[model samples]
Target: MNEIEKKIVDQFDVAKAWSHVQHLVEKLPGRYTGSDQERQSAEFIAARLREIGIEPQIQPVDSWLGVPDGATMRIEAPEPIDIPCAPDTGRGQLISGEFIVIETPEEARQLAGKLTGKIVVIPYSYSYPITPEEARKQGAAGMIYGNWGPSDVDILRVTAPQTWTYWGLPDPDAFRIGEQEAIPQGHIGRQSYERVRDLCRKGKVTGSFSANIRSFWGKSHQVIADVGPDHLGDDADFMIMAAHHDSWNPGASDDGGGVAVLLEAARVLHGARQSLKRKVRFMFVSGHENGAYATSTWYLDNHWQALREHAICFSFTDNPGFANAPEFKIEANEELMDFALACARDVVGDEPKINVHRANKTADRGFFGVGVPGIYTRGAFTQAQADAWGGAFLGYWNHSNHDTLDKIDPVNLERNARIRLLEAVRLCSAEILPYDFRRTVAGMRERLEGWQADGRYDVSGTLALARKFAEHLDAFYGPAGTRDAARTNETLKALARELSWINYTYKGRYGQDIFGVDLKKPLPIMNSIDELAHHAAGSPMDLMLRARIRRDQNKVEDALRASIALVTSS
Candidate 1:
């Protein structure tokens, strides 16, 4: 290891850091998003950053900060069946009708004629959840949904009142149908629904339901923060570290963990300002739990120029406590992969036991859709524990309220924090930044090709557009060094910042109907940016470039396949 790397390893304080993280975790429950508690938590983090010699800024978020008013759901049955339901966040209107039973898509197509004005109950398939858009498109007035399992304990019953999250994406057609202000929806357990289906197959299965849901409530907020070196020169780039601060019931794993990591990062980096060669900025975001609309969209609009200058952003989130369990490799922007892998070596050490994902699935890294590569560091649960509890199979309490800090292991958190800290420091001080354009190109091509292979899209035109975007990336490459470092750094930072804004907006508001062209038409631009991230390390991009290069590249088939992958969950 290099002299600096060896020193960083020596300075890592595992036990002390663990104690500090525990203290922070204990104080987190009081800081649920949108409440005064949340604001207080932000202040505390900012104060800590200041003490470490870094100036912290609070990025204001656009949010509806208040208790969601009345909610309700009801079945206006001729003879009521005792089933439970609740008012989803933003619901409206109430319409009553008899339930129509359909067993297959064929049945749905046939019943479409009569189902338009009636409620519909289709058997729940083992794969895929029932989506509202599909039901609406099929001409159903209301829905009686069924899931794969029985109703587990309803944890929401005990959550602190006045707590709520972003209810899906914003929609003007949104409505509610229930006893209180709730959506007109209900779910029957797997066994109960199967029984209902059998009864319907034998004969008539009819029931009526309605919901009196309320209209839209107050607005929501999105907070942002920008702090870094004032001058790194025009071509000098930056390393961005980010995470969402909001939560779903204290959101310990989904993002509370991420917030804490960023806080500690800012503290350490700000304290070691003299050794830094590149600029560092930290973003403590909100609304990621609700789908990243407010912060992601607003950032794109308000600071498009700044984002274009960002080098790369590292995202920290989820139950870092699972580090002791089976190791899943790091799948990140290829340019950043080596840095991540190196940090893994330094922090994770050599291990024959676990796999690492370099080109892994995307997270907000996917959100950086603009191609600026970023990393999501959340350790998964032990293989045995995960297998025993299917939920744990996906790393436990994903969106559930049980994501408390108590669930985290101090050793796990300390290891995760060290890896993140070293990665950030190493990247900032590296002689050559670590972005890989070729791999990024390959990744985008893969995504496009995957979409077309699914047979659902005719996006050949997008491929042609993608190649053209690749050219823009080729024209932008420049050499890095200390003499030009100051100017080069500023240039890189400006571009990273601007790229961040563009990608944020692009991801948040891509599919929305914008001006005639559907603005998201430029997805390739962001994809190309991710390619540049891969070029960061001094290593030749050629050897590592073939990882995702598909020999059979078909645009139409690839586009369709990519589209389907976006919808179907594994």
Candidate 2:
């Protein structure tokens, strides 16, 4: 690496980085999807990216963060009760009606009597979380739920140090009461639920609910910036370093820390542009907390072709601070599991207990929808802390108003950023790509086997598909040296491994094991590799392509869902 690259890589000032992130916390007023708070946050990021001499762009999004017109609920049995409800960023149609009572979904199923003018209530079950989904399943006009389980608060805190980041409030949206069936709904905690349930038990039970929501169509933005040489030739592939700029919760541990790391890393990279062999693009995205991934979705639609041809994607967000939790872990691109291990070793140096696992099947990477592999670093808290306060990985406070700068520790931010900076630099500057194949293949085979055992799939076709992919994997990695051979070998191997993970792990069987696809897949996965890859040699085109893929992968997901539905039906 040249002097400039060295200096840029070395410029991660912990204190200044923390200050930058701290300042941003005040600007983020609420959930990332809607509200002026989110818009201001996006603008600040764009300004910073522009200051770095990179063209910053804005993207309009349908933030479900609609202005709350109002909502009310009334029960006309025994004693009348009034309840409060709020609009979720993930919007649902307005609904108002009397509530209908059903014993179970099966009972509700048998009594599928017209509910166009009624809300639905089924007794709470031990499986309360899934109960709303069940209610939606039963074709209820809308849901008025009473929980049987405890509702606990989730707390998040981080101790990492880096640049400025915005912390904002969580979306006040209700749970997935409607995503499954476009129904309006509301839930009451266990304590309050008992009163409602007791009243329902009385002979005459009647309830009415109504919601009025005001929403505006506007644009949001995703900012992209770059560093190092502009023309690195077709043979080079960049390692993309990324983070989502918007937040839910003050977003301190959730991503303010991650954003700080990205800015600090970018500052270093921009300062030392000459030594980079490949390009490094920094992406600050919005819409992560709502719309699932509006910004990344937009990027994929616009830039996926480039992603397919020239890049490796990496992303960082969420709590990358304190490491004293049960086990500070790293989720890696399964195909390059060993490669990630090698990089991690370089940064923490023999921290044997830094548990590493396969990617969580989805995150920002899945938006790329292809074989692009990425990682979701483990939350920064210990097991005990996670149990008590909820760790960095989407705790109760994640999108709540609780995500503030006060929850973060400067020391934790500094350590995590330094680790990421080193990782990114190594990847960007390395001569020989370090992505591993055998281990990834092993992981895939294991996954395929599990799917077969589940009997939920027609193993024949999917298994055949898996074998073909494995063959491609073997062919891609066969070449040992020679520039073209090595480049193709490395890139294809990495792509195949990631694609394999995306196809098999992200959706099919592996994803099913982890609830539904509630997470964006591409960006987070890319963030995992961005830090280390940049420290070595990386390609900007590669980074750009990943950004595009991060935006485009949804098509694949849609297709996959269609195909899977067909298979299951057959």
lDDT of 2 at 528: 24
- lDDT (Cα atoms) of all candidates against the true structure: 0.48, 0.52
Candidate 1: residue 556 lDDT (0-100): 25
lDDT of 1 by residue, 1-570 (tens): 567655654555555455445545566564444555556566766776676666666665554232323333343343345444332233445546656666654565455447666666654332222333455665666666443333343322111111121222333433222123222554444445555556566765555443322332333333334444555564545656766665555556545566666666666666565577777767665544433234554555565455555545555454555534556445564445666777767777776233444432222333343335566554555556654443333443444446566666666666677777777777777654555444444455566665556433334565664555455445445332233544444444333333322323333323322111112222332233233233444346523432322212232234324333321221
Tens digits of per-residue lDDT for model 2, 1-570: 345434554577887678667867765645355657767776777777667776666666543333334455677665677754433212445455556666553555455546545676643332222234444555556765443333342121111100001111112332222223345555444345445556656655566665443444445556777676766664556666777766655677667777777877787777666666667777777666544455655565566555655566465555666434334567766555666565555545665357676565333444334445565554354545544431223343444456667666676666566556656666666665566555654554555565457543223444554455556545545665554644444555334534553444433212221223222233232222232322233467455645544443443343334433322232
Pick the lDDT winner.
2
TM-score of each: 0.64, 0.67
After TM-score superposition, what is the CA distance of residue 354 in candidate 2 from its true location, in Å? Answer: 3.6
For model 1, how big is the CA root-mean-square deviation? 11.0
Worst-scoring 10-residue span by lDDT in model 2: 160-169
